[model samples]
Target: MNIRNLAATFVIALFGFFTLNLGLDYGLRNTVPHVLQRRLLNRVTADVVAIGNSVIASGFDVAAFDRASGMHSINAGLGAAEFAQQYVAWKLVTNERTDIKQVVFGTFDYSVTNTKPTKWTTWHSNNALPFYADPSWSIRYGCASRADEVVYLLARRVPLFTERGGLWTKVETLRRYLGGVGFPAAQINRFGRISDSKLLLEQNTEVFERLGRSIVETRVPLVDPVADLLKEAQQKGIASFMVLMPLPADRRSFYAMPGWKAYVVYLRELLSQTGTRLIEATEWSDSREDFADFVHLSEIGAAKFSTRLSEAMQCAK
Candidate 1:
């Protein structure tokens, strides 16, 4: 090829690459993790920052928690988010406001396993990519961690491949969220709350039952990373708490999965050794109506749980 033609081609490729990445970042606004990034940047001060997966996001009643505890609070939960992503978010929030006094991490043993379905790109991990110092930093790490996103970036050109890459069902999620036309019963309200509604009628009746069938793995990929985060929190005199939020009555059978009980025991022991408080949902209450689905808490359920949480924790009130 002629030198001029080669130079033109190179410029086109670079421009295309940047455009693709920026589009994905813009589309990510539909997700909880992307919104959390904006939340982290705002000069929002809080005494407590609740961090976890969607369960925590839906289950923790931020308004109730703040009112009952007498501490300003915000929920920094992300769907499918695990420890490393949350730790990074913790750093970003702490960097912005030195006032965060406590961390409430709602998690389960099953989440720690490194058994994501092939082609899934976790939002917790993906959302952090844009925060890198340069574009290449995110592209390099993103491709390394989850190449499927790379495929999805290009797949939009193919007629048959219309589905979104990563965990997204479609690209409309971003627009739906950004436009404030979120799902029927669940919309992102104040403090990132996703209020429960009958509009979110259960589609998969067997979801919890399916979860019950999966064997729970005992391994945690970010063990040391979490330990390090705890150490840093301790240094700053910030208290850390972990909540094993409840599963629906029928799906609570997940506890019976082989090794799951042991995993819980291991987690409890690990938390005790690490000096973090552990709260099991069954310890104080077990209301069947609290669950929106097999895993998440309904709005009423979250309010009840948060009240109980405040009543139980000395630091909370």
Candidate 2:
């Protein structure tokens, strides 16, 4: 063959190889976002759907809530998700399913603000074409629209950015699963007895003060399209509520910036204007040890907190 014909043949082969690899990657990683997992909770149907970031994702157990309240529930939490991304996800789900009688949004300081957009990783988009169609949002424009796409596409060919944390967590999860232990039990038990609660509280207060400063500087407006959606839901006889997930005890002092108290008061007042109830899980004193991080729940903490949430919901009803 001539050189041109030879080069053409090599190019065609390379294209075929990439297409096949991307297909495999999508198959392995793509699953519904945890927030959308409400479809599988039970045959009984849920009266409520909870949505938020990692705190809501790792901290709330829908199955336990369902059993405790006799109300089917689904936790649609996303990890590391900012409000803009979350708003898109919520819009997509509610647009498709109208039966979701209520939505419980786990509000947090960061959830109300915007952040620099992150690049779209293959793990997040799952090789889905539609994921790239909308590029107007500030976060999408910042992260996905840069030359990073070329880097991501090339990295996929080499498995250079494979999810190490997810893989390790999955293995740990499987070990627990095979041993017939329930979720988060091992992590919770690792802490042992809980006497020095005040020590952790002091630490948390510092963290909260720092977080509060960020909130004030960004002035990122609270993103609650849910008020409009709730109006539609109420017209159709549905209900909605917003819950502010608790922080570690020391978060308040650690993160106590100038506007922190005012911000909290603002959130409460905003919820009232929309006629949606607010549940402050942070008000409970015994709730701090359940956290896996400063903000997320260890599995044991999630179960305990979910039970408390169920009880609170019942009282609200």
Candidate 3:
């Protein structure tokens, strides 16, 4: 073909491909986010909706808490979520369920920041697209950079080149495929998602904690966006509280880099300034045995904390 014809064909194909990408992103139902959207969109009126990162996502057992508290609840925790995504979750839950009398936000050192790859990973868009159709969500929930979007589409969705996660998870996936079985039970429900698995006995907590600390400290800090949301909820007469969820006592000292210590101090000041009710992880002291990881509570831990949270709500009431 002549150069002109070849270039024209290339342009047409590119446009078609881009259109297809858009269609797939919006049209197809997202696996994880859809669950959350359905939970919120359902006509159920929950008294407490816990929104945070993975800490509470899989950590809090909403059903157990509901049984204990005698109040409806839901856990809207996203894995690897930072403040921006959690705030969106908060908005989503409250907006959909006006009967939400209280909101329990799971706050950590980095819960107020966007340094996490919410945009690049399409975590935000995955949740927002189902209910929030605004074009702005493309930037808010997706990679703002067109170049990055191209890369994500190529890497994540393209069949031959999907992200396989860590080496162990890869091995686990292969094991399941080869062995005609599945990974150990991953229980997800409208209440929440929690793996029944326990944290590995010899897991290298220190190294992972250090790496997490390093990445967080290098990013520019953000103001406590949750504070504003809480303030609004309070104004609307929606009771609200914060949970200063830190790593387990054993690993906290090792994990809290200098910057993290400073961030905690700042967080405390912010809470004091706003008069936000708080449930610090240290207060209850979840046993090290109850953790599935450095912070996420296991099922037994979830049972314990869910009861504690229920009792706390009783006191609040």
TM-score for each model: 0.64, 0.62, 0.63
Q: Candidate 3 — which residues are off by over 4 angstroms?
A: 11-23, 26-28, 109-224, 252-268
Q: Estimate, for each residue in 192-258, the C-alpha lDDT of model 2 and write its tens digit.
A: 2233322333345455566666565555555533444445455655566777777766555433456
Q: Candidate 3 — which pairs collide?
A: none
Worst 10 residues of 3 by lDDT: 159-168
Which candidate wins on TM-score?
1
Question: Which residue segments of model 1 deviate by more than 4 Å?
Answer: 1-3, 12-31, 113-222, 253-262, 282-288, 315-317
lDDT of each: 0.59, 0.56, 0.59
User: What tens digits encode model 3's per-residue C-alpha lDDT throughout 1-317?
Assistant: 99999999999998887676666555444445555656666646677888776778866898788889888888888765545556666767776456888878775545455344455453333333223322322334456678876665555553122211222344765674676455554454333233322242213555545544554556444434465677767777787777765356675553345654555555555555555566656435547767666557778777788888778766755
> How many residue pairs clash in all the candidates, one count each?
0, 22, 0
- The predicted structure with the larger TM-score, 2 or 3, is 3
lDDT of 1: 0.59
Model 1 TM-score on a 0 to 1 scale:
0.64
